[model samples]
Target: MAAELRLLLLLVCWTALASSRCEFPAIFNFGDSNSDTGGLSASFGEAVPPNGESFFHGPAGRFCDGRLVIDFIAQHSGLPYLNAYLDSVGSNFSHGANFATAGSTILRQNTTLFQSGFSPFSLDVQSWQFNQFKTRGGVAYGKGGVYRELLPKQQVFSKALYTFDIGQNDLTSGLFRNLSIDEVKAYIPDALAQFSDVVKGIYDQGGRSFWIHNTGPFGCLAYVLERLPVLASQIDQAGCATPFNELAQFFNEKLNQTVVRLRKHFPHAVFTYVDVYSVKYELISQAKKNGFGNPLRACCGHGGKYNYNMNLGCGGKKKVAGRQVLVGSSCADPWRYVNWDGVHYTQAGNKFVFDHIVDGKFSDPPRPLRLACHKHI
Candidate 1:
């Protein structure tokens, strides 16, 4: 009877492991505004209303009107929405934490192009924060010495997904500073070096599953189209700036090459290079078929061909023609527009992109969303 009881206990343990829906116990994300849950708001107290009006109904510190792709990813992966690392009160770090910040660059140094100011917490800084979190077991320990076992086992860190969506700011900042595309391309090696160091640092900390997204098509963004010089002939059939799109393609090429090298360096690591550029460009190229009404215009902001006014920006009140007026206002339907407030995507746009990329075809190893948890297991 005792032997039978021991056999039953073994079966129960096997069943629990087999029935587990998600492969990884947690997901630790690193990026810029593209996936910043609340790091920017916690740091600077910005990202107020109209910013998260769609689903959240209030500013959740995400750059979108509603949810980010990362939020959708968390939901799809059977994990809770990742909380910002800086959020101290009532945050459940068991699912994982987001270390992304708005306006974050890959390199620690401030870019001279476009007067892009220094980010207090860049990717390097975020990686450092991750190291600190790993050392402390979780953010709760750092807060008050309350040793909560967020990452209980050292093996849990190896099983967690380490995702990234950065480096756009590095390229955009150079472009904004009036640096030529050639000059911007020259910075790729240095940016990739920094990115490599971050990945290596995480690897050293025992992170093995990586999902790194390449930068999207920046040329198609309303902000870039408004600021950069574009000839009428240079515009594509989809109304995107072709020259800028080419630049983005070039950057992706280089990034893919770097990913190949990283794969060689970390042979045992599951490094999925997410093709964000292709997925986003397809949405713009086929907007009419994809249920989008305005692919090139922004849902908010004022005074430009693309409805993106640099002076007004997004969610800000500005004096236009000597009168104080709201410069940015929500459109009647944000779902119909691809670009939101010039730079970021509308919630609908983000969902569309997420749906396409989550299938694993966009990933290097082709690990589907449902299998992401089991890929390394």
Candidate 2:
């Protein structure tokens, strides 16, 4: 009788584990500018010409020459591109919704966006927005018909893959405020605590699969190089500021630890931590070897050594001889360049990073993106 009971328990355990492997029907993303589709544009204004010229053929609300990494992730999953939750016009939320906005941080800031250039829609606010989307979507879907075709099925929430690509802005928010590097690092724990809160909130709402991206090496970005200039001696072989890259590495270490803790806390949920910093650093450092142009220079800008002007940005106009002239124009071959406009990645750069990570080469637990739903244990 004892042996029979033990066999029954084993069968039940095997059944539970087997049921965990289902196709990911949807993707729900939360992040900053890196993954934003159109959330910022919907609130502010269009990203404007030459922004999406490479692949989109026109302005497509992305701060790039074309699609973002998130777009590629969706394509690989056989899911439609996620529409911005804020963008009401011609948006379809059947497969997923993007709550990311440019200049977003993991934690809310004390200063206003106009003052410091950070978004008010931090991780907490974004999680609250998700809750609202789920609740309101359920109401709209109950009527069926067009609503059913638009919003996701209620069960999709539990089965969806949740992706996060934030926390970079949190570090920048401190730097831009004239805080020392150590000062910025001091608050990272607080920032990550807020991040964990959002994850727990989502888990409570039945989100079981998580894909979190660590912040990239901002030292290689033209904007950071220009804003926080370091001595020539401090510049690494890659022409990147070593201090900043070191700081980024420290941040990534902490982020990895956070993911490990989360996995322990929620054994049932699958957490995938992606090392985006390494992938980005590799591309930027060896850009020319990989058939790319100047890695640090912007494809669209006004002037200066890095082809970037803080005063006027991409799609910016200058009054030349009393006439408005488009100064921040695109480079001849955008695909050959690594940086797009001093801040964000170009479509080519985005695709390169996606290609490397899509196969799970850079992800924790070493599982491919589409198979993120499966728990290794």
> Candidate 1: lDDT over CA atoms?
0.81
| Best candidate according to lDDT | 2
Cα lDDT tens digits for candidate 2, 328-362? 99998999988999999999999999999986768
TM-score of 1: 0.87
lDDT tens digits by residue: candidate 1, 270-375: 7778898989999998999999987888898776788888777778786779997776887989999888888889999999989998866677655555555443
Kindly give the stretch of ten consecutive residues in candidate 1 with the minimal lDDT sum: 109-118
Model 1 misplacement above 4 A: 1-22, 111-118, 138-154, 319-325, 373-377
Clashes of 1: 3
lDDT, candidate 1, at 191: 85
